[model samples]
Target: ATGNYLDDLSAESHVILTNAKAEVEILKAQVGDYLQFIRNGYFCLDSKSWEQGNRVYNRTVTLRDSWAKMKQKMGL
Candidate 1:
């Protein structure tokens, strides 16, 4: 009876450990997915910021050219 009880306890412990390990793996996968999502968002935002900077630079250049043309025409 003692040996049988010990065997049952060991089997139960093994089952619990297996379940815990599977749960940990699932949580790890979820974390990985979230991290990748954050990385993608960061890249998207960075690209948008760069595009905006380019737009501002182009506008500034256009404004400067127009100003130069106006001054030349006005004999300044």
Candidate 2:
């Protein structure tokens, strides 16, 4: 739904919200994994993992915003 749909797009918003929630959960788990991996000293100052975590965090924020929109549409 891209977070800009009109009020009549609740169906699409619901679909987007479902997918976004799933993605958020997965990305959160991935971040947790990265944290554990880093703690194990697999690589110090690992740019790749840090970059991935940042990307996931950003996506999660967008998804959460989208979810908020969906909830508002649904009158929740």
Which one is best on lDDT? Answer: 2
User: Candidate 2: which stretches are off by over 4 Å?
Assistant: 1-64
The global C-alpha lDDT for each of the candidates, from Candidate 1 onward, is: 0.31, 0.38
Q: How accurate is candidate 2 locally (lDDT)?
A: 0.38
Give the true-structure RMSD of model 1: 30.0
23: Cα error in model 2, Å:
20
C-alpha TM-scores of all predictions: 0.18, 0.18
lDDT of 1 by residue, 1-76 (tens): 4667765563433221122122343333321132122211211123343446521101111112577799999999
Residue 18 displacement (Å), model 1: 58
